[model samples]
Target: MNKIERIRELVEELNKAAIAYYKYDSPIMTDKQYDDLYDELTSLEKETGYILTGSPTQKVQGDVVDNLEKVDHKYPMLSSNKTKDLDVVRIFISDKDAIQSWKLDGLTVVVEYRNGELYKAVTRGNGTVGEDVTHTFKHCVNLPVRLRKPVDITFRGECVIPWDTFERINFELLEPYSHPRNLAAGTLRQLDANIAIERKLEYYVFDIVDGFDSGNLIGDYAYASDLDMPVVEHCAVRDLGEDFNKFNPENFRLPVDGLIYRYDDTEYGKTLGTTSHHPLNMLALKWQDQLYETTLTDIEWNTSKTGLINPVAIFEPVDLDGAITTRATLHNVSYIEDLELGIGDSIMVYRANMVIPKVHENLTKSNTWELPDKCPCCGGEVKIHNENGSKTLHCCNDGCQAKLLSRLTHYVSKNALNIDGFSEATIEKFMELGWLSSLSDIYTLQDHKNEMKVLDGFGNKSTEKLLTAIEKSKTTTLGRYLYGLSIPLIGRTASKSIGKYFKGDYSKFIEALENAFDFSQLEDFGDTMNMNIHRWYVKYSNVEDAYIPKLLEFDTPKFDSIVDNSSDLSGKVFVVTGSLEHYSNREDLVAVIESLGGKVSGSVSAKTSYLINNDSLSNSSKNKKAKEMDVPIIMEKEFLHLIGN
Candidate 1:
């Protein structure tokens, strides 16, 4: 193809990929392939002296939508000039100290604090106008709703969902998010604050836009830290050569696109000025991905507890990032269709952010691969589910072995039944030996003890420990038992909320479930979650061999120590901040508050009855909110005294 034609084609392809990656939370192409194509487009544009108006290279800001109210930013939200070359970074930081931090791959938000309370949060739309997402951000983990100083300050930060939270959330969804950045963006723009809260979005302050007088970036970070602000992980680097390699994005728990280096001297950075697109003071360095070619051997479909079938690509082993890798996730049917994958096809793969193994390209376009029509584990009818324009495979059978195994594994997990010595692998082995087939089988493991001890990896000592742990687990509380059931949309938090709502009475919880009661009336319970809970109970409650009846035979002591329905603090919201002296830690204090029928919220708001801070006079955001809202600011000792402790 001619240069102009190829450039146009590349532009179209890159724009589609960007839209999929940023707007839809689904990536059709790998980062290496995109970068390679981008480089080719840049070269061709330079050679032809022609650039398309809609070229992806020319875009400075992300996609903007009308889902939320738009407001013009006081300071233009500029992008950072980026390069893959460390030499450019060295030149950019010449003789001055620089602050290097991860360029978090998430939505950029400008949060404004007025009179010590969060006034607004807006996205970076077209660098000038942005969407208002304050309501959604109010539930963001670690984000302060009130400032200690009551200062009117606007700061810039990245709203992100951590990798762990992203994985867990995606694990339950039929159409999983392709990347954390897109998920974070979508979650932040959600009209419902409860959705954002459930997803557990977090904000990390990276820059002070309108508050600080410090001429140094490090000083600004220190000032922000003093206000108990969640700041991005960063370090002062005097030598780029010595420290650049150490600031690897892979080490960060949050998803990061690259590393950012900016001159610490604020005045000098200002003197460098900025372009319409990017500031001259800051430079972003993206890692050059190393792609490896491998032969796809087969596709493995694994069924999850939600019945969603996930595709795993098994390929010839290849060393990647010092580990011998033989497989990578295909994500879903759409991903396979996009790649036109087939067995024995030569495909290119790379480790995303030097961590996740991903298929980048298909060198041989042999589109012979077909999705399984039957469930791989149970040979049941497999159905295709279309959700939000994404296709996913689901096992239609309720008795699918894989689903049962997953549910059983979840039931015995640390956050659920707290059963020790029972790994998923061991459970699978037990299932193979006919020792386990359902959740109730876990309690009756002793019946097969003599046989289990003779199996591989199981001996007298190990079997004894396993049996002891299982016996001990029989004394779990209602919250843990509910969590162990693997109810859809019912995680630890929801289980605890439900447990507390019913005062940890299993019979009351069962009665509510049977009566089809409106569980949304409970705090933090949404319609979808309530529906999931009722559906689960209705499906299994009547079964003669249901796990619930089997589990009820065990001891379930009342959770009286954790909650008291008659306390004066009942239904009141308290925000605890800073160090605590009356309690062992924040968790201990939170437990006490929850037990007293009080709710502990992360952020202070108008509904907050009190702000619990040892230093009540301190200028923290929670204290500021209390002062502004005329809420009581009480010390730990005073709070204890009020509770008659």
Candidate 2:
């Protein structure tokens, strides 16, 4: 084979190996085999100057834009004709070799390439027009920024977030997104490309609109995949049911709604034409939800960190997908009313996307469920909160055990008090035993050493360690103590700034509060933050049992005072953006920079000594601005090295 033909073959083999390994967790090539082929491809491309758009060596570029602009598509982005019946799919592909693949559940995107480089990407807004999302599209890790051969081409694909990625993101969030598709769509439309990069969106090319004429749908997919562009997993099949059974959601990575079947012959499909709504060439087989009927046993009211009481429906256990589920969140009071749930009422339940258990329909509709007038955790008065036409229950009592649990959890966290072995569960158990009521009670836990040692999950040694950690926490920095107090608008960064301004002396901080000193004088402390600080201080100080800093000793570190401008970073201005590895967030990094007597700016300018972004190659607005002004752009590790870290 010629060099160009060999390059195409090598690209196809390498991409197939990558898909098998990364997507399926099944490796078809040995590590050495993959590497050797990759090296050979790299050398061949360098020698011939013939790089395919989907080459593995290509660096994907990303850009940040201010907003999404509307664009007209060269081809109308029509949907596929859909049905829930297998018979309909069979009829569509009767006696003809057809291509079948997963009907992916994600944001449909049309990507266009000009001169072998990605030029534009747009969402399927309507049939003829779409919102340009090229900025975020470029951030997609699996998306090819350039295709082999310098030619204009258009392809359609679905930009999807993997189930694991979705779960991981939602796990860290208080109010999680309901579905992966929703998160994917939101991430793709984000004005900042970094959001898409952070989410790690993947695009799988399913159809080609121009440039390549493969004569068949499967041929098109093969050609696209060989070009190094990710293609949807497909197979040539004459029977829909025979191939349908092969798909198991348990083994799949991407969220799929159902299966899609299309005519193999492209020319023959064109003869069938299209409807006003969708193309007749392809038929989408949507999965019918499997539901189980069960009795509604009870409704559990769970209080959140913010004192909101959420309702959870408890029903007779029913097997959904593969797991037995007995409970599902009712969301709020409005949802319960909408479902008209009642004890012992019959209801139908199913897993949405075969993942989240949901109540499909309430058959009985008894409407006997009543709202609780008291808090489930503290027996305190409850009030209905009407937010955006939806009614939610909130615990009115400030000292509700559930609310106290949240505060205590944060108080003993590593970033706050650095208390060891004080898990939220342990704290709750201690609170339940009437050993803890306020922040001061934490120090008093030593009084219950004998009792605590005898408790379950706590031996004499474990109890002693907890007491030691608590005692050691009493000599922490003033910044930590302030953050532990959970003051409104006073986070770790703000608290640290305040602590530094006062020389890490608790007395000076208290004196400033007493004299009504304006907190907005501090860096990054706005008028709203100042108001929140004063309001929180006034309310907290008025409480008779508030946390007393006199019980603890504040650290006076040598570098505690920001007034001393002797650091190497002094007189320098840095602009930090994107995600961080060493620091928790941008605010954390900013605090360190400020502590070293350096200034931080929101934008890159002539005064910017350096722009700190982990993704140095990113074409984000900040990076672009820094380049235009000749400002040095450094990665997190390089910046750390500069500061002697």
Candidate 3:
């Protein structure tokens, strides 16, 4: 294809992607893939000077949704010139002191504050025009409703849902969001402010567009901070390469796509002028998703407890983000068909958010891969289920052995019964041997002690160890046992909430069930959750020899004393990062905090009372965020002292 022809194709493709991302809240491609194509189009446009009518290079991306009121931006909110190379950043800085901050991956909003109160908030719909989202923006948790000095101001910041909130929301969603950015955008664009409040959206001011006159980026941050507003974490950097090398996105609990470098002198930056699409004074250093090409070896379909047969792609093992990853979830049947995946086809994979391994693209689309006709575990008939345009495979047989195996596995999981030596593999082995089927069968394992001792990889000592662990697990709390039951819509947190209501008394919980209690009345419980509980009870109670809780002893539950003013840690929120020396693990530390009436959040925010990290001076993301929010960073000893340990 010639340059002009390629430009038209690129323009159409990129435009479609933008619509899918901004309008539909769905992404057709990864950010890195989009950036690469955009760069190619940019180079083509520059070389030929033949930019198409609707080329992405000619305008800012995103569209103002139909329901929102379109308002022209007071000043153009242009995109920034971006690069994936460190050399480009080095050139951009060129011995000038730069203010570096995270380029947060979320929807950008231009908020205006007048007479010390928030007047309006608008999205960066296009460079010149935007949708007014003031209603939803008012619900942002960290938004400064009333400025300290009652000064008229306009600032630009990101409206984001923290990674933890995103994951929690996604867990309950059938068609989960692709990323936090999508969720944030959807939440803010909603006409109802209640949606934004429930999602717990946050705002971090990055730039003072008007009202506040700060000489540099640092002063701008200080001005925003003085108003009790959360600001983006930043630092003065002389060496771009050093800071970039030290940056690790994984350390941050919030979603950040890259880093930004802005000239410290606001006046000097304005003097540099602007391009049609980007400002010359500010540059973005995008962290490209590193893709590894690997050949697909096989596809595995695993039967979930819900009888949903989820597809997992097994590829030639490749190292991604310092880990050897061989498998990535295909998500559903639609994803498989979309990629036209096939065994032996070359595929590109990357670590999403620097954590979950994901298949980015299929280089060789053979389209030979076929859906499984039978369930892998029980050889039962499988059916394809289409829900809300997404297709998934499910086992038709209700009594599939895989389902029972999954339930038993959950029962013995660490957060459930805390039973050691009963790995999923071991549980499956026992099920095949006709020694395990239901949760109650676990208590009867001692009856086959002799047989277990002689089994492969099992000796007299190992048998005794497993038996002892099983006996110890019998003394677990009601919350753990409830979670182990694997009821629909009842997660660990919900189970704990229910358990707390009954004061950890199994008899009291059973009484509530018998009396047809309205579980929705409980905190955080909804009609769906309440209905799920009743439905699960009806089915489980009818099962012959269903899990007998009487066989186990329930310990008294420890409720968090959040409202108790006596405890020093009460009402305090802590975020733990890095390695633990005083505690066994991060979970253990979190437990201690909870027991002392404190809450532990996954990310640092304005609400966080303290950030616990041994390396206080470390450049970890959590430390930077805490410093930015002015939250106290405490050593383990300091934390212990604060709690009067």
Best by TM-score: 1
The candidate, 1 or 2, that scores higher on TM-score is 1
Model 1 bad stretches (over 4 Å): 1-214, 217-259, 263-284, 446-464, 520-526, 544-563, 568-645
- Per-residue lDDT tens digits of candidate 2, residues 1-645? 367756866776676665544323334543334545666887799999998765555521111222455455678777565566688887888898898888898878898888889988887764465677888989888866678677788899999999999999998999776567778878887888888889999999999989899798878888888777899888889885667788876689998877888889999999988755467788887766667899999999998755789898999988765456788767689778888989999998876443445676899999999899899998999999773466789998777888788888988998787789999999999988988777668888889999998999999899999999887676556677778877766887788978767755667787898899998999657677788888877766656444332223233222222333344678899988787776544545776686667888655678899999999999888899899999999998887777666
lDDT of each residue in 145-197, candidate 3, tens digit only: 68888888898999999999988998899977767898899999898889998
As a whole number from 0 to 100, the lDDT of residue 248 in candidate 3 is 79
Ranking by TM-score: 1, 3, 2
Model 3 scores a C-alpha lDDT of 0.80
Q: Ranking by lDDT, best first?
A: 3, 1, 2
Candidate 1: pairs in clash = 116-147, 116-150, 146-621, 147-621, 148-619, 148-620, 215-266
lDDT score of residue 518 within candidate 2 = 93
Task: Report the Cα RMSD per candidate.
Answer: 15.4, 17.9, 17.9
Candidate 1 lDDT score relative to the true structure: 0.79
Q: What is the C-alpha lDDT of each candidate?
A: 0.79, 0.76, 0.80
Query: How far does residue 412 in candidate 2 sit from its true spot (Å)?
Result: 2.8
TM-score of each: 0.51, 0.47, 0.50
